[model samples]
Target: MTERTPFRARVHAPGAELDVQAYDFESPELIGGDDRARLDAALEAWGRQVGMLITAKTRAVVDVATAPSRIQSFGAFIASAEGPVLWATASSAGGRILYRIPLEEARYWAARMIGAAGDAAGDGAPLTSVERALARQVLTEQLAELQHATGGMFAEPVLEAFGTEPPSSVDRDAQAVVAVIGTLRRNDRRQLAAAIDAELVLQRLGAVAPHQDAAQVRTRIGGHLALAPVEIALRFDPTRVGPDTVLDLAAGDLIPLAHLADRPLVVTLDGEPVLHAAVGGNGERLACVVVSNGDLV
Candidate 1:
C-alpha cells in the first residue's frame, strides 16, 4: 500500500463539452474495371462511327479519338470549356453530349457540307439561324450513327438544345457525372473537342450485356457448323428408271446419273445441287474440280 497524491477531475459545463467518435468510413463503390472497359470499348466504337459519318457527309477526312473517361461533375466540366456548344441528347442512354467547334472549323464544315462558301472573316460570333440549323442537322446525323454503333444500347439521339450555358442542374449531382472527352480531327489539321456526359453510360453498358451473351452463342454455333462435313456425289451418266423398273432391275444393271460423258458434273449436298464442276486430276488422284459455284436449283 502506497500513499497517493490528491486526485483531481475536470468537467465542462453543459453545451460546452465536445464528444468525438472515430470509426472507419467506407468509400462508395465505383464502376468495376471490367464494366468500365466494356463501356470504353462501346464509346470508342461510337466515336469511330461518328467520325466515319462526318467524313462521309462533309467529304472531309475526319478522325475521332476517344480518350479515357473519368467520374466528375458535369456542370463544372461544361463550364470549364467557356464557349458556345452544341448540346444533344440520346434516348435509352438518357445522357447529353456537348460539342464545341472553333468558329472557323464550324463554318468550314457547314460550307463544305451544304456546298456554300464559308464566312472568310472568321469572326467568333453566335451562329446565324441558318448555321445553327445546319449544325443541328449534322449533329442529328452523328446521333443516328451513334445509335447504330451502340447496337440498341442507346436509342435515337436528338438535338435537344444548345447555348453558351448548358443545363445548370439536371440531377442533384449532375455536377458530379462521368465525363468522356473525344477529339475529332478534320483533314489531320483542325480538332474539335466533344465532351460526353456519361451519367447514363452505366445503364447502356448493362443493357448490352445480355445481347453480348447471345451473340457469343451465335458465334460459337456458326463456328462449329462451318466445320461440319457434307457429302458430294459425282455424276458420270444418266439412266432413268421408274419405281417398278427399279424393283425388277438385276444387280449387274447400271443406273447412271448423267446423260453424257463430257457433260459438266454437278455436286449435291443433302439432295440439293450446290456446284457445277468438271472432272480433273489432282496429283494423280481424280478430283471434282469446281468450275462454278451456285445454289441448289
Candidate 2:
C-alpha cells in the first residue's frame, strides 16, 4: 500500500445569478412590419381624439402626438424607461394595462385638475392628497370614456390603484408593448408611456379573420355559380375512326365505342369534365353517384 498525502477540499464560487431586469434585450421582436403599420394608423386617429379630450378635461393647451410602438417585456420596459413616473393600473374586461406619465407631466395635469396652472408639485415632490385624489378620479373616468368612445382596444377601464411605482403583483417577465403619447405645452415636451398587455394589442391588430376570408370567398362564388343554370352533358371517350368508316355506317349498324363498359363516364359542365360517375340506374332512370377522381371503376 502506497502512502497518500493529506486530502484538502476546495470551494467553488456560485454561478452568477441572472438579473432579469438588467438582462440585455437580444430577443426577437414581438410585432412585425404589417402590425407596426396598422398600429401607426390607429395611433394617428387616437392622437386626434386624445388631443381633444386633454383640452376638454385638463384645460391645458398641449399638442398631442403619437409615437411609433415598441415591443419588450415589462421588466425591460421599466428598466429602459427614464425619469420618475406616476403609474396607474387600468383594468377592464379585455385585460389590465399599466399606464405611466412622467412626474413632470403628471404634475402639470394635476395642477390643471385643481384649477391651477403648472403649480402642482413642480419641484419633483409628491402630489398633495387632494391633487392625487382628483388625479385618480379624472384618470379613471377619462380613460374609460376614451375606450367607450373609440370602441377600439380598451373597454371600460377601471383604475385599480395609483402609485409612485408599478404594483408589486405585475409580472416582470410578462410580455408587454409600449406606446408613447407625446404632449407639448408651454414649450414643454413629455411622453406618456403605457405598458399595455401584448395580447390585447395583438388581438386588435389581427381581429380580422384573414384565414377564413379565402373560404368565405370560395363559398360566395360557389353560391352564385350554383344559382346559374348550365347545360350539362355526359361524355364518353370518342372513338378514333377514319372518315370512310363514318360514311360506311348506315341504319341499324352497330358502332362500337372506344370507351370501356366497366369504366366510369364523365359528367361535363359547360363542356368541361367536372365529375366522374359510374353508369347506374336510379328508379329506372339512368343516373350515377359521383366517384373518386382516380379511376372511378
Candidate 3:
C-alpha cells in the first residue's frame, strides 16, 4: 500500500453570509409586444383628445418604466374638470415624478390655460372655476365626437376609465411606495386604456404648430361631419312615433309626417335642421327646395 498520505482533515471555514431580506418581486408576466403596441396606440389617442381639450401652449407627456425598489420622487399637475386642482408627485428616477392626474384636472387645466391666454390677448376674462367646469362638460360631450371621428377605432372602456375620476389634488410622493404598489394593483385593463388615450391626446395637442390658434384649430378639426346617407338612415331615431304605433305599422303603411301640405320638408344634418325645402311633384318624382324656417308642423 503506497503510504496513503495522511488525509489532512481539511476543516473548511464557512464563507461570509449574505444579508437575506424579504424581496418583493413585482409581477413579471411581462407586458407582451402586442399589449405594448395596443397601449401605444391607445396612449396616442388619449394625447390627441387632451390636446384638443387644452390650449396650444400647454403640454403633456406619458411614459412607462419599471418601478424602483426604493422610493423615488416625481412631480406633475393635478387637474380636474374644475381647473388645476394642484401639482403633486412622488419620487422617481431621472428627475421624473410618478403621478395620477384625474381627467377632470386635465380638462380644468387645459381650459384655464387657454382661457388665461385668451384674456391676456383681451379676448375674454381668465377662466373661472365655473367656466372650467363648463369646459369639462364640453369635453365630455366631445367624447362622442372623438368616437365618431375615429370611426370607433379606439375602445370606449379605456376612455371612460381615464376620465372617470373627478378633479382633485393628491400627494403621490408622500406615500411613494404605497402609491406605486397601489397603481400596479389598481390600474386594471380599463384604467390602462384610459391612461393611454389621455396620453395620446395630450401628446398630439402638444405637437401642433405654435403659430396656429388652438381654438380655431379645434373648430376646424372637431366640426361634426354629415354622416353618409346610409349612416344617417341607420341612425334615424324612430322614438318620434309611439312604441305601440311603431310596432303595429305594416310594411306597406306609410308613416305620416307631422308636417302639413305645402310645408317644406326639413332635412337635418346631425339632428340639427340645416335646410328647408318645399315638397314638389317633378313628374313621378318628388322634389324639394329651400324654404322658410319653422318647427315641423
lDDT of every model, 2 decimals: 0.59, 0.70, 0.35
Per-residue lDDT of candidate 1, residues 1-297 (tens digit) = 966433222334435635544332221224557877766676678778877876776776666777755555555555556444544443334676555554555566677777864436556777777777777677777767666776676666666665444554344244222434344553344444544555466566663343457788997887665555444566544576689878988979877654576667777664667677788887966777777664533
lDDT for predicted candidate 2 compared with the true structure: 0.70
Winning model by lDDT: 2
lDDT of 2 at 294: 46
Tens-place lDDT per residue, model 3, 181-228, is: 111212321111121222232233343234678888775654422111
| C-alpha lDDT (0 to 100) for residue 252 of candidate 2 | 95
Cα displacement (Å) at residue 288, model 2 = 65
lDDT of 3: 0.35
Give lDDT tens digits, candidate 2, residues 16-54: 443333323633466678777777666556666666767
Q: Which stretches of candidate 2 lie over 4 Å from their true place?
A: 1-27, 119-121, 207-297
Candidate 2, residue 261: lDDT = 91
- Residue 239 accuracy (lDDT) in model 1: 70
